[model samples]
Target: RVMYTITKWIEHKLGLKVNATKTHITRPNKLKYLGFGFYYDTKDKKYCARPHASSIQRFKRKLKQLTIRKNTMALNERIRQLNQVIRGWINYYSICNMKTHMMNIDKHLRTRLRVIIWKQWKVPSKR
Candidate 1:
């Protein structure tokens, strides 16, 4: 009923045709909205939103590109690029509730950096 009403309103009041194939009823938690996922907060007694999983995966992919093992750029340059990516991503996602997820990402990023540095050293003794 709600969807039908909305569709009619769009067609009549807004003079816009609703694309039936693109529309569906779903709980907000099941959909990504502007890279955010909405969920009810039990402790806060309200609702909240967080950076969606696909956004996090995109961030990881970007970091992977920056930290590829064979990229011969100096480690410092790589770190600088990483810093820019992390800072910009965090700044945009700061409003979301994702402390634990961020911490895990930080740990993984540090491990990747370590691997890059280790690869640069080349010799077991030097590493």
Candidate 2:
């Protein structure tokens, strides 16, 4: 009933149409908003926020573009660019209680960096 009233209010009072296909009525913990997912942490006995899987995948895709092997950008310049992007992303998502996810991403990022360095070292003697 409340949902119907709110939908009507949005359409009539606010002069905005609500898309039934996109509308969802669910608990906060079951909803994803702005790339973040909320869930009840049984161990902590509290609600927590974390990046959704899709959000993480999107970040990884962006990182891959930045770190692609044939970019031709100098190593220091590439690192500087990567740092700028990573800092902004971390600052935004730090509100989420996702230490494990962050750690895993860090590991994956390090591996990518190693691969980039290896590719740069084309000669076997350089390795």
Candidate 3:
């Protein structure tokens, strides 16, 4: 009932159409806006938005692509490209709370870089 009334009010007063299919009444934490979702920050005692898991996964995918061993790109060039992507992404999502996510991505990225370096070295010496 409330949803219908609100939708009607928007259509009538706001002079706009509300698509029923797209409208969903849900908790803030359940909704994701621009790759970010609300999370409760215990330290601040309030809700804060953070990059969603899907968003982080997408970022990791990019890192994986850049760090792929068979790419044959020079190490310096690959590092530069990786830095460019990381900088832009960080700046855009800087406002969101994502310390833990960053840490996890760091670990995964380090492992990928190690694999890349190993491949670049071409051969390993038995110690």
Cα lDDT of all candidates, in order?
A: 0.89, 0.88, 0.88
1-127 per-residue lDDT for model 3 (tens digits) = 9899999999999999888988978887898889888977789889898988888889989998999888999889999999999998899899998888899888988888888887877666632
Candidate 2 Cα deviation (angstroms), residue 29: 3.6
Enumerate residue pairs that collide in model 3.
none
| Segments in model 1 whose C-alpha atoms lie over 4 Å from true places | 14-17, 123-127
Q: Which ten residues in a row have the lowest lDDT in candidate 1?
A: 118-127
In candidate 1, what are the lDDT values of residues 9-101, reduced to their tens digit?
A: 889999987899878889887888789988888898777989999999999999999989989999889989989998999899888998988
Provide TM-scores for the models: 0.83, 0.80, 0.87
Q: Which 10 consecutive positions of candidate 3 have the poorest summed lDDT?
A: 118-127
Candidate whose lDDT is highest: 1
Please give the lDDT score for candidate 1: 0.89
Q: Report the number of clashing residue pairs per model.
A: 0, 0, 0
Cα displacement (Å) at residue 85, model 3: 1.6
lDDT of 2 at 10: 91
